[model samples]
Target: MDRRLFIKLLSQSALVSYGLLACPYLGWAKSAFDYALEGQELIQQKNFAEAIKALKESTRIDPNSDWSYGLLGRAHLGLGQKAEAVAAFREAVRLNPLDTYSRMMIEIVTQKPLPKLEKKKKPVSPLEQEAYSEEALMKSELKAEEGLEYQVKRVVIDAGHGGFDSGAVGKSGLKEKDVTLDLSLKLHEKLKADGKVKSFLTRTGDYYVPLSDRTATANQHQADLLISVHINANENKTPHGSETYFCSEKASSSEAEKVAALENSVIKFDEPYKKKAGYIDIEEILLKFEQQLYWNESGKFATTFQERFKKWLPLKSRGVHSANFYVLRMAKMPSILLETGFISNANDEEMLKKPAFREKIVNAIARGLA
Candidate 1:
């Protein structure tokens, strides 16, 4: 039987059978199921505005339905409401932790800038919520300090891509994985020698680490901060600059989103998250809330790092951006990703190959952290 027809008949049967019982829960389930089906059909017809209305009602009727949230996200995306799309998708992922599609959508939508809405007061995106919470937490911590010194003393440095995952390759044969690993090592040594901060590298040698494991290592170490380093690339080979990124539920721009997508492409290498037996939903919610609080601090630190980094580096500054990076998302501490330079650009590739230039890059990061 056709899947849609089968679903329609099943829904009809459910409504009739439950109507005899006059069960309130059954009424809600039937209505939600019907609305979800209608919304999905409208989406198929490209009637996004109507689909959104139907999906919203579906979600309101059954707030725990991951399917409804996912559909709402799709409708929002279709309308170019990126921030709303991200929020909806995030809820879907929270409800159904195994929903990889919703997780991927969160990554994709976050990389692009939030569209300007005509409304007077704009709704806060998840990124903004995180930043605000982080700011509040920092203020409270500082108030508690009462003149005591505060500092980040331990750090994690992750070199993007490795082993068979060569990352982007330059025309001059310089691989992104090698460059990132070399730079990470140099930065680690510099940080260690500074005596002010202790640093650890996610990988000390050329080998692949799953995107999820990189952050897992940081959380295990109880690190104060994490800096993920990478060499950027573009097909045009004209874009060359240094950019810093912090985790956000929505991307700051289309270009920023694309950069994230490229980095996240390594998700193919990741093994699925092992489902824990008898997981508590409240615990997961609290964990996510705590992570959101750290993101604001990450954003502030990223901006500071970019300012310090641009002063010493030869490359042009692209400034700071925010996007949903799987590597940055799970870290319990402030985390940022650095795109040092575009390997695809001829000039930047040559600079990246030189030891002096690499040392300069290392110095900039060390100084930035300090």
Candidate 2:
């Protein structure tokens, strides 16, 4: 591929900023993550040389930081250093086998140079040009991979707010934790019985598994996908519907922001909160640049998921949204959180309380995955 194949970043609006460290945003001192963030900013400013220096410090602090390595690749790509970019991207994919973004970049770079494209009547922006190149390469790659399809053999189903965390409550006294567990159990069973994909559950019973552990479980299982199931709620009790969520620093809407806040409220129980929140190691920097790519892919998957999930449900489809969900922040693979219905809504709560309705929701999930 030509060095200018990708002239722009993943998305101009995607992942503008992230909580790079655990403590109080970025404190006085800097961490490797801070350097990485600086590198990202430099790249945005089109300062590839300075970006490379910052990213080098990031890798020097933690040689195993795949996301940082991937950033190094982008910086190199920005400088039109094809060999250097390939090296960085390869190291990233090596450190994290599931980094499809880096892997795809490697393939795109090493493949034969793209044929020259005719100039358009309207001048294209860097972002648009990058998109066109990616689209062309992705189509070619998809065709060669498996006719634009892949068989998902492994899946991790997470039941949100286990143990003492009674996620949400309805007027009828239904518990969100209980509902999610039941739905996840059924979804697991159905996926197993269908003989299409092997499924794993984050928690087998009512035990509080930390948010980090949930994604860690998926990584340990080497799962192809992670689906954290949760029931929605609101004080107003009016927003009653099914919506899918993928992770993003900037929430797609206010409703999405609120939903993410509600789900991420349990993070206070996690161990990371104990740290001083500054100068953390690279192993601990879960949210990386690669996450932007994964979240973008997650958004695409959420759309397809909603299309399939809404077919078997009686609830209104509220469509797909993006928010910075803690549980979704660290997933190495594409991950999504499913808000089946609002438990705060009377009709939704009533339906959620029924066994038959739970079954339908699980079936809908299975259908969505298929």
Cα lDDT for residue 358, candidate 2: 89
Best by TM-score: 2
Clashes of 2: 1
Question: What are the lDDT scores of the predictions, listed in order?
Answer: 0.80, 0.81
Residue-level lDDT of model 2, residues 42-158, one tens digit each, is 987779999999999988865766778888998888776878988998888777665666776776677654333354575667665666778688778766874333346899999
lDDT of candidate 1 at residue 174, scale 0 to 100: 94
- Candidate 1 colliding pairs: 110-250, 110-251, 111-257
Lowest summed lDDT across 10 adjacent residues in model 2 is found at 7-16
Off by over 4 Å in 2: 1-150, 273-280, 283-287
Clashing pairs in 2: 23-277
Cα lDDT, model 1, residue 43: 78
Instruction: Give the lowest summed-lDDT range of ten residues in model 1.
Output: 9-18
lDDT of 1 by residue, 29-124 (tens): 346656787899997666989999999998786677677788888888777677798899888877766566677667555544333334455466
